[model samples]
Target: MEHRVVYLDCYDGITAPLLLGALFDIGLDLNALKKAMAALSLPAHTITSQKQDAPVSGRSARLALDAPEKAVPWRLADTPALLPPGTLKELVRQPVLSMVKHIAQTTSKLQKLPIEDVSLPDITTLLWLIALTLGLDMLNVDENYVSPLPMATGSRQGPHGWEPLLLPEALEMLIRVEAVWYSTPDNKQVSLEGAAFLSELASFEPVNFSVTQVGYGCVPGKSASDGGQSLRLCLGNLSPSSRRAPQPAPSPVQTTLEQAESETDWVTVLETNIDNMSGELLGGLLDHLLELGALDVSYTPMQMKKNRPATLIRVIAPPELGEQLAMSLLRETTTLGVRFQHMQRLKARREPRTIQTSFGPMLVKVKYLGEQLISASPEYEECARVARERNIPLADVYEVARSEVQTLIIGSRKKT
Candidate 1:
């Protein structure tokens, strides 16, 4: 099916008003948005926007919730009354509450108060949450992929003192969502409203789509800081892409394995070169790194600096665990520095299954490309142990396990 897709380039960070403004610029129905907002029946609010073509060109939104009503502290019970009953509610009701609960839960911990007793500071916050959410779903996009976030490292003088560009609230939410981010020298600050709202709506994955329209969401800045920081949104029709499973080997009693399914997400690669590390010491780290949440680790022999033979240690891990793994590497390996970068990884979906073989039950990894099963490989460690216990060759133990799974697959296919 052809799907509408939006690519959000959060190079500078995002804001709820900026988000909705971009969606509005990209053809979100203004009347429909007004109608959806009206269903809430809260105090009156006005949504306005204007085109800006000065230091920047885009649409900026102004959301004015009524004074007294908008200041009401948010409660969990207020969720049901936040949205009217309809498709929009069905799509976004839980996400809106989930976003609120995340804040409330964090607020509870920070304040040393009970969770039920915590409430968002004001209803304006909740209104913006629902509005930003509705803005996205109301577009009816099938998928939205967010670009890697930029950690604005530069700071400036604040009224209090020197302050970091990204605030504590925004940083906390970024961690909660496990955002894929990279350090930037740029001084753009991300807001909690932006990060929290986008977390529940989009993914950081690869997409192949031809953009139909591009909209910039920014308000013309009264000063330099606010002027150029804008969220770039590209709307497009998604090109269907599928990971096809390789056809399995044919047999007389053919076991049509299920196709392989695949998933894509960001992973961090930690690499460093070492010239004076012992092979024995480096080899011992394979298991050590695995225990430290490394997805995979390996070493490659390479020539570094004229004639020095070095081993390049590479570690692939979840971005969230990258720092921990890097720390472990520095402490354990004879390396001075570790370089890390986040990259999107596409891998076949696989699950563990136990099959009764001649040597009893053995574990195997059942891999799928989608609905089709491509291959079922016996677990190496388990097969090796079973071979030793049964006093049989390892290859023979593997064959027995493979045959067992094949028989099961064939029988199941026949029944179906």
Candidate 2:
């Protein structure tokens, strides 16, 4: 069986409660989730559900702040005293520790406090709750692959970041759903039955993942406010191409003949609107799409109704990968729905080659037929780096790269 990975692009921000709600929406048995949370020995936080109405339709799940009135702090200084004897055995698993690290980081960011300022007890309690959610053996501890929490950004506020206690369990549900979702056939990504439930609930398009493993964590705060508490779920897996079997090399003429034989290539254009996504998450999603064999993907800034800023995501991928890619758009970003259109295209045959540059080697996509080189351009990564380091516009760097490549080939011909 092939293992897939799902990447959650948490750009705008993530809250523990929303994660929990999404989990409940996906099919996590509330009773089981509660039992795992109980083992953590935390405060008496209650979980409740309701019909959520987004711009699209109705959804059923737990509210992040079940009852703001009933809220009480689970302070760090009181952790050890609260834990049941030997229950520590089940509270220190990898899933638990990973959650602790994430929750602590988010809390620190929310409070605008240093990670150094976060109480150790709070971290411990968070970890214990994660263990409780997973029902993992306390003795089965292992190091995690990725670091906990993202590096703190400059924008943050408040004293303590902790808010929701239901996030970890909620994340466990999402992790499980994402794992199973990634395993469905490529066509399922955009099918009415595949992402229908999630899309309707969140009012966003969807994101596709080759999800292999999922790890859960919690963040303090509520979703109503920008940086409130939430759950962080890490969906891990490789890109689609990496999963494919190797193909034998073809001779130059054979490749040309095969290219001629290939019918007009068709692809779908996917578009979605997102209000809460961060710039960082958008970048990650685009990179992921390219890795998944997308021909092109881009985002544009726009003002959504109510005068709030938003982004419009656009992607062009092979027809087969269309569904998964579209779902990924909704799953990873804050988009509720996505529009799709199919179109055919004609392209000159192309080959990928590397060209030496003044800074280093740069990759170029060259379109050609027989001995004629029709067109070529420097890779975007190289151009972007040069533009940033030199404090120049990207277009300027592109012009320079093209000039350099042309000069190199022309000079070589003269020398010959």
RMSD of each: 15.4, 17.9
TM-score for candidate 2, please give it.
0.32
Predicted model with the maximum lDDT: 1
Q: Write the per-residue lDDT of candidate 1 for residues 1-416, one digit (tens) a residue.
A: 44578899987678787777888888787788788887775667878878866435888777887676446676754565565445354446656766776666566666788887876656777777878778888887756778888788868886769978876667776676678888888776577677677556577666667788998887677544666567789998863343122347755433322223357667789888999878888988878999988999988999997799999999999877886887787668766456565565766678998877777778888876665565687889998998888798999888878788788767655775
CA deviation > 4 Å runs, candidate 2: 1-263, 354-363, 369-371, 380-401, 408-416
Q: Pick the candidate with the highest TM-score.
A: 1
lDDT of 1 at 138: 82
User: TM-score per candidate, in order?
Assistant: 0.56, 0.32
Per-residue lDDT of 87 in model 1:
37
- Output the lDDT of residue 323, model 1: 68
